[model samples]
Target chain A: MARAGLNAERLTRAGADLADELGFDQVTLSALASRFEVRVASLYSHVRGSADLRARIALFALAELADRAADALAGRSGKDALAALANVYRDYARTHPGRYAATQLRLDPETAAASAGPRHAQLTRAILRGYDLTGTDQTHAVRLLGSVFHGYVSLELGGGFDHSAPDTEETWSRILDALDSLLRNWPD
Target chain B: MARAGLNAERLTRAGADLADELGFDQVTLSALASRFEVRVASLYSHVRGSADLRARIALFALAELADRAADALAGRSGKDALAALANVYRDYARTHPGRYAATQLRLDPETAAASAGPRHAQLTRAILRGYDLTGTDQTHAVRLLGSVFHGYVSLELGGGFDHSAPDTEETWSRILDALDSLLRNWPD
Candidate 1:
């Protein structure tokens, strides 16, 4: 019989916690079952399988990150908003490395379309409003910002900046200043 | 007796091929042994364990990528060199997704110091020579370029750019142009 108190929400929360404790890639249905002290079969009632569990976790992470981004971006504009948004991502990654990694999971087309990804894109466009870009230029700028934020954070978390001169914080601030300047004076 | 044809180099090469076929995270000592039709114990003579195998693969990928970058940068300067370097990374990632992913693995400080990572830094600085940046600003520029190239390629591979209009290629070319322009006019 299915566990009386277990449900997908609770199970997924536990799974996310497990991911945080272990690594995201270490998450599996078998491990979650062990954590719950239930048979692996019991999990099937809540989560379809490993793939379903991962997809749920990915959705949860996207929603959570999107919420944080939206909150950080509130009541801010221009460079302030840009910095706030960028820090939100970096801070979240540092605090919740597993969940942040989950946010990078490649979902199927259907799941991706239904994900909070569009909200992220909209947020990026909102930041671009402070600058004068329009049309294709705006789209290109969005990709650039996404690349920088994602790349820098991934590299930092991977220890790329460790044992190097000039602390990462200084480099981060300088990069932001350069990005803001570049956006302000975007080429024609 | 140890397999006559089996050695650490051959095993590492086979492991790299396995990584390319089944993804790096899936490569294991047991799998390689099975591939060789040898007992797992017999393979230990050739590879210390899975960790050693992964480290070797990472080192191999780094050297290969650095070599490609060196070749691409030869006889090129300015934006041409930048574009060539960026394309090398992108193309390599597209052609060898597993090896490219391995290049992102976190090696110990000692292992990293001995890897071709410093060669990559030198090449990045070489490209920066075309710009007027020096000292810390040059370091910041190197980080920025690394972030963009790594981030954009990671996102593109993760299907973040799929189903979008204006095409990813357009964005890539425009991003390079913007980067070149930004480097030319870096703020004081």
Candidate 2:
């Protein structure tokens, strides 16, 4: 029988907490076992190993992010929807850096297809409904937005904007404004 | 006496090559020592340890990237300059994933200030000269471009765009177009 308080979900959540505290790279099975006061062999019953634990954490992060994004996009539209969705990612990264990092883990195709990855892509597409894009233009815009949101947040988190004047929050709002303008008047 | 054929510069360069072959996280003093077929202790003369070695590699990558950005930005302006600069990052990341990852490493403020990091900022500012941005708008635009460039390259490298339709090249060029239009329009 499984341990009274330990299951795959429970262990995965603990691993994520460990990641948030010590960083995703540090959330190994052994470290998790130590945290749970169990032997590494005990974790093997719940998680295959380090990679499996990491993947589960990654999937968990993706699902959590998708849930937040869905909620943020609930009633918003146009630039409102755009900003809301963008904030979902940036805010998630800020509150949960380690889990955010896990979301970037490159999953195998089969696993990724089954994960919340598609929900993310779909949410991005829904944001485009507010703009005047179509055909390949929609696809292009989606990629552009993904790049900007991911790029800006990671750079900010990495201290890329620390030494610069005009704080990041101001820049972020302006970026959203600029993106809105770009989408409204996308080039031919 | 020091080893006849080994030195700090050579070790750093070899470490970078190892990064390109393996991932950046895998580059360590012990690993570099194995690559050089020398005792790990022998490397203490060149580097403090794994962190020091990684920092050196990061500095090397920042300088190399700055050099390439400068080369790409020369004799170009407006969209021409923008495309050239953008391509520099994408091409570099594609050709040298590990070294590219090193460029993202967070260094101490003093080390970052002395490194070629500032040159990257200056080159980015030069590209903005082609546009009408002034004051913090320039800074915001700079941040935006950095975010987009870094974000897009990392996502593409991570296969975020692999499962999508419309080849990344098409989306890339369109993104450039959208950025150019946004910069030229400069929402009020």
Candidate 3:
């Protein structure tokens, strides 16, 4: 019998909330079972197990993040678009750290292709369209941008910049400025 | 009484090796006890528990990485120093994935001050001396470089660049080139 209030979608949202609270690593099936006041076996009907639950959360977070990126990209280009996209990630990570971490989960090839991963790449490409890069140069710039954003956000969230001077915000803007300068004058 | 042939250093080394085999999360006091063929209680004599063991591993990894970075940076400047420092992290992470992950563990303020973390920052600053950055600009550059290197290595390690076109090596060199170009022409 299907539970009136419990389904994969509902469970995923709850699990995501739990992840934000306890962290992505702590959002286990047993923990969710406890939260829902349901048996672990019952959850198996809605989702396969722990891995499946995490995968669902990952997919959910990816879609949500991609949507935000798309919204941020509308009618923006160059450094404006870059800052918009970058801030979306930094803001999402700060506000929903667990969900942010979940987006980093490595999905299998088939699942990854079906997820918002491609949209993320496309959105990044859109920002690059403002630059003069093309072909492999564009791909390289995409990877570089991905690295800086991911690295900076992960470090900031992990307290890597908590003790540093000059403030993270200053560094963030300067880094963006530097990226804009680099993109405009990309070397051979 | 201390156990013969067993000490904190030895246990930490064994734990780091086990982390490489099973991942950092899987390295626990009980697991180390099993590896040592002793009881967990006996293991506690050497280290407080799981947290202490992990902290020690983090410090050890940080020191090892700093040492390698310092060595790679010898007799190099400008882009050479940058690439050398970047390559040390990438090679160390590829060879010692577990230990590399350990270096990222968030340490308490006091512990962080005492760890090789400061040296890692100093080494980064040393690279910045090759450019025109100073004061906050230098700090911003430091944070930016840290983010790119950390972000790129992490994504690569997590297979983010796998299944993508142009191969990671090409992207890596191009990123270094772009970074070199950016540092040379940082915006005002």
Query: What DockQ does model 3 achieve?
Result: 0.87
Candidate 2 regions exceeding 4 Å error are A1-4, B1-4
DockQ of 1: 0.86
Best by DockQ: 2
Q: After the best TM-score superposition of candidate 1, give how far the Cα of residue A39 lies from its true spot, in angstroms.
A: 3.0
The superposed Cα distance between candidate 1 and the true structure at residue A175, in angstroms, equals 0.7
Positional deviation of B26 in candidate 1, in angstroms? 2.7
Q: lDDT per residue, candidate 2, A56-115, as tens digits?
A: 999999999999999999999999999999999999999999999899898998898899
Q: What lDDT score is found at residue B106 in candidate 3?
A: 82
**Winner of 1 and 3 under DockQ:** 3
Tens digit of per-residue lDDT, candidate 3, span A1-188: 55547899999999999999999989998889889888888898899899999999999999999999999999999999999999999999999999999998879988988899888888998999999998999999999999999999999998888777988888899999999899899999
Candidate 3 chain A has its poorest 10 consecutive residues by lDDT at A1-10
Best by TM-score: 2
Tens digits of per-residue lDDT for model 3, B74-187: 999999999999999999888888898898888998998899988988999999889987678888988899999999998898778877899999999999999988888888
- Ordered list by lDDT, greatest first: 2, 3, 1
Using all chains and alpha carbons, the TM-scores for the candidates as numbered come to 0.95, 0.97, 0.95
Q: Itemize residue pairs with steric clashes in candidate 1.
A: none
- Output the lDDT of residue A44, model 3: 86
Q: Per-candidate interface C-alpha RMSD?
A: 0.6, 0.6, 0.8
